[model samples]
Target: MTTNAQQQLQRYLRNARYEVLPLRGVVEQVRELPAGTTVTVTSSPAKGTEATLDTAARLRDEGMHVVPHLAARLVRDSAHLSDLLARVSDLGLTEVFVIAGDAERPAGRFTDALSLLRGMEEIGTRPYRLGITGYPEQHAFIPDRMTIQATDEKARYADYIVSQICYDPNTIASWVKSMRARGVELPVYIGAPGSIDPSKLLRISMKIGLGQSMRFLRKQHGVVTKLLTRYTPENVFDELSPCLVDPDYNIAGWHLFTFNEISKTRQWAIEMADRLQEVPA
Candidate 1:
C-alpha cells in the first residue's frame, strides 16, 4: 500500500520544477537524480545566455528534463534569438525560464522579458513549457502596475509563473489572488529557497537579483533570509499551509532555489515531505 506521505510526494513530484544552480556539482547531482526531476537552470544576463544553453544541454545529456533561463537582456537580435531556439531544439530542451535578467546594461538590443518572449514566438520557438518571473514584493526598477502588465504580456506565451522569493506569506497569498483577478491565469510554481547556508543564501540572493527583498534581510539580521538556505518548504509551506486545507491560492507546488547545495536541499525536502505525511491529510 502506498503511504499518504509517498502519495503526497508523488503528487508534488509530478509537476514541480527543480531549479538547479549552474555550479560545479550540478552534473554530478543531476546524474544521481531520479527520472522525474525536471531541472531549470537560471543564468546571469551578465554571464552570457550561451552558458545557460550549455547547462541545459549538459542536463539533457544526463537524461533530465532541462529548462534553460533565457535572460531577455542577453538576447541580441532575430538571428541570435533563432540560433538559441535552434540550439535548444537540437538539445531536446522542451522548457525555458524567461526573465528580465539582472544586468547593469543590456548586452545588445533586448531590454525586457516581454520583448524576448515576443521574439521567441515570432521566431517560432515552441517549447513544451515557458516560465516567467513574478515579484510579490516591490520591484526595484519597475512599478507594480508595470510588473503586472509584464506578467500579462508574457502570460500569452508562457505556460507558468514562478514567483520570486518573498518572506511574507501574506504577500504571496495576496499576490496570487491579485494575479487571478487581473486574468493572468498561468499556473504558478511558488519559488521557495532551498536549504543551503545562511551566509551563502545572503550572497546568493544579492547575486541573483532579490532587489528590495534584500533590504528586509538586512534589517532582520538575515533571520528570515537564512531560511532560504537552512530550511526548505518548511519555512514557505508554513506560510502557504492554509492553502493545502482549502485552495485559496493557485500554488501548484514549489520551485526550489536550490543554490547548488543539492545534497542538503534534497535531504531537507525529503524530511519535510515526510513530516507533511504525519499531518493526516
Candidate 2:
C-alpha cells in the first residue's frame, strides 16, 4: 500500500516546477507556463550569469515566479554584486539560488557560495528567500565531507535546499537521513530530469560535468542508455514517494531539470498528473 507521504509527493510534483538553462528559445518556452509558476534559470560558464538574470527578468515581467542562479565564482566583486542585485531588484525578483559555480577559477574574491551569501548580507538588499544547492550523491570533484560541511555552513543563510540531479532514490533517502543526523533541516526540493532524448541529455550532462552521476547511471547500462532514448521521471517519482511523506524528511517539492525541453516536459507533467489523479491517491 502506498503511504500518505507518497501521495503528497505525487501531488506536489503535479504542481508547476521547471529549471531552465539560459539558452535560445527559453523565454518563449517559459511564456507557455501558467502565471506565477516557479521557474529557475541556471548559470553557465560559457554564457555567464548575466544570461540567467536576463531570463529571470523576462519571466518576472511576464508574471512568472523567477529564481535566478547566482554563481559565486562568477561575481567579480562587491560592485558587480551590487549591480546584479540592482538588476534583480528592478525586476522585482524575490528568490535566488546560490552555488559555488562550475568555473575552473574564481572571477574575484568570492571563491565559494558562503562568500557570496556573506556579500549579500553586507550589501543589505538580499532577496527575500535564498536557496542553496545540495548533493545527494558525491560531487564529481569535491570530497563528500567538504560537500557536507558546505551544506551545513550555508544552511543558515538559505530558505531551502534544491538538490543536484540525482538518479538514485536510495541515495536521496539516505542523504536526507544524513542531513538530519548532521542538523541540516532546510526544506528540500528534490531534483529530477525532465523528458530529454539521449543525445541532448548526454550533452547537458557533459556540459555540467556530472561525471560521478553519469558514471553511476552508465553502470546500469540498459536503463542509463535508455535514458537517452526517452527520459521521464516516472521511476524517479515512484522511488521518492515514500521519502516525501516521511515525517523525518523535510522534503518540500520537486525541481525538474528541463534541460530546455520545456514543451515536452510540461506535457509529461500534465499527463502524469492526470494519471495520478485516476489512481487511488
Candidate 3:
C-alpha cells in the first residue's frame, strides 16, 4: 500500500505552500517557481481585485496552481464578485483563499471574510478548496472571542485553515489542540518563516496585523531587532515534527510567508528536507 519514495514526496508536498504578498513583480516570482507546488497570491483591500484576478489568470497560463486571495474589503458588489468568480472559472482555477482584508474603510458592501464566503455560496461560486486564516495567538485588533466567532463562522465555508506564522512549535501544537477542543476540525497549514531577512519579514508581519506572528517577533525583540536575523522553518518543525510524525494531529503542511523571498526560502526548504532524509530516518 505504500512506498518510501511515495511517502517522501507526500511529505515534501506537506511542507510547501508559498504565501505571496503582492509586491514588485510577483508575477516573475510565480513564473520562476517549480511546477505543482501550491502558491497563494494574496490581495489586500488596498490592491484592486481586478489586478489580482488578472495576475491569477496570467499565472494560470504559466501552469501554476495559484490560489488567489479574494479580498472582500476590495470587492464593490455582487456584480463585481460575479465577475471575479467568472474569471476564476475561465482560468480553470479550483481554489481560493478568502480574507476579510485590511481596508482603512470598507470600499464596498462586504465587510468581512465570512460575508464574502456567504456571497460566494449564494452566487454558486463554490470553489473546490477554500482556505481561511487561523490565529494561534491573539489578533491585535479583533478581540479574541470575536476572532473565535469569525473563524467558527468561516469554518462552515472554508476547507482548511492557514495560521499566521508563529515561531514557537509548542504554541502551534497547543493552539491546534485548542482549536480542536473548540470544535474547529478543519485541517491546518502551519504558517512559518522561510529563512529570509527576519527584519523585513517582521516589518511585513506587523504591518499586516498577523496576530501571533507579530508577537513572535516581539518575543525575540532583544536579538531580532538589532541584527539581520534569519528565521527558518526549524522553529515551526520543533512543534510541527511531533504532529507531522503523528496520526492524530493531521498537520497538513507548511504555509510559508515568503514575503516574495521565494528563491531563498524554497532553496532552504529543499536543502532542509534533503538533510532530514540523511539524518537516519
Candidate 4:
C-alpha cells in the first residue's frame, strides 16, 4: 500500500519548481518540461541581472511560469530597481526570488535582500508573489541571529521562503520549526540539488559558500564513494518525505536546483512521481 508520505512526496515532486541557470541552451532544456511547469531563473554576478531577466522572459514566453532571481547587490539603485520591475511587469511575470547574492560588494544603494525589498516597496510596484532566501544551516559569513532577524523583517514583504540548498533533512526540519516558533510563518520550499555529478555538485556547493553542508556531504563515507559517478537526491527524499505530510513543516514543495541538468533532473522527477503512483494504495 502506498503510504500517505509517499503520496505527499509524489504530489510535491509533480508541483516542484525547477531552478535553472541563465546559461546557453538552458531555455531549450527547460522547454522539455511539461507545460505549466514553474521554472526559476537564477542570477549570476558573472552574467548580470539582464541575463537572468532575459532568460526568464524567454521561458515565460514559452508558457512556463517563470520566477527570476533579483540579486540585491546586482541592482544599482532605485532607478535600476524600477527598471527591473518594469521589465518584469512587461514580461507579465508575477513572481520573483530575492537574495543578498554572491557579489563581493554592493553595486548600488541596496546592499541586502531586505534593503532591496524596501526599495521595491518604495517604488510602489512589485511582483504579486515575492520569495526570499532562508538558511537551514548557518551561512558562511552572516551570523545565525542576523539571518533570523533579516528573515523576520523580510517576511513582511515576502510571500514565501526558499531555503538555500541543504543536504540534511533534520537541519531543514529544525529550521522550519524554529522559523515558526519565531513567528515567521511563510511557506518554505526546500532546496535540493537535482541529479548531477557529485564533483560538480561539490564544486558548485563550495563556490556558493555552503560550508556546513559541504562538511556534511564530506562525512558521508558511502556517498563520497558514489561521488566518483553521480549523485541523486533520492536519499534526501526518502529521509525527508515524512515531513511533507506534517502540517508543522508547511513545506510548500521542492525547489530542485537543476544546475542546467534539466533533462536528467526532469526524467528523475517523472520516474519518481510515477513510481509513487504505481505503488499499491
Model 2 clash number: 2
Model 3 / residue 188 / CA error / Å: 0.5
What TM-score, to 2 decimals, does candidate 2 have? 0.92
Clashing pairs in 2: 5-245, 198-228
lDDT of 3 by residue, 1-281 (tens): 13453354347544598887766687787666777668888787556776677777777777778898988888788888998888887788899999888887767888989999998888887679999998877777888899888988899998999988666677778888888887888888888777788678768666656655545655765555543264567756644665765546656787887878888788877776666656643
Q: Pick the candidate with the highest lDDT.
A: 4
TM-score for candidate 1, residues paired by index: 0.87
Q: Any runs in candidate 3 off by more than 4 Å, and if so which? A: 1-10, 13-15, 209-221, 226-230
Off by over 4 Å in 2: 1-7, 206-212, 215-223
Candidate 4, residues 133-212, lDDT tens digits: the string is 99999987889899999989999999999998888778888899999999988999988999877778878787678877
RMSD list, candidates in order: 3.3, 2.1, 3.0, 1.8
Clashes of each: 2, 2, 0, 0
Tell me which of candidates 1 and 2 scores higher on TM-score: 2
Tens-digit lDDT track of model 1 for 116-205 = 888877877767878899988877677888988888888888888889887666678888889889887777887877776777777766
Task: Give per-residue CA lDDT, model 2, range 70-128, as digits (tens).
Answer: 99999999999999988887888888999998888999999999999999888886888
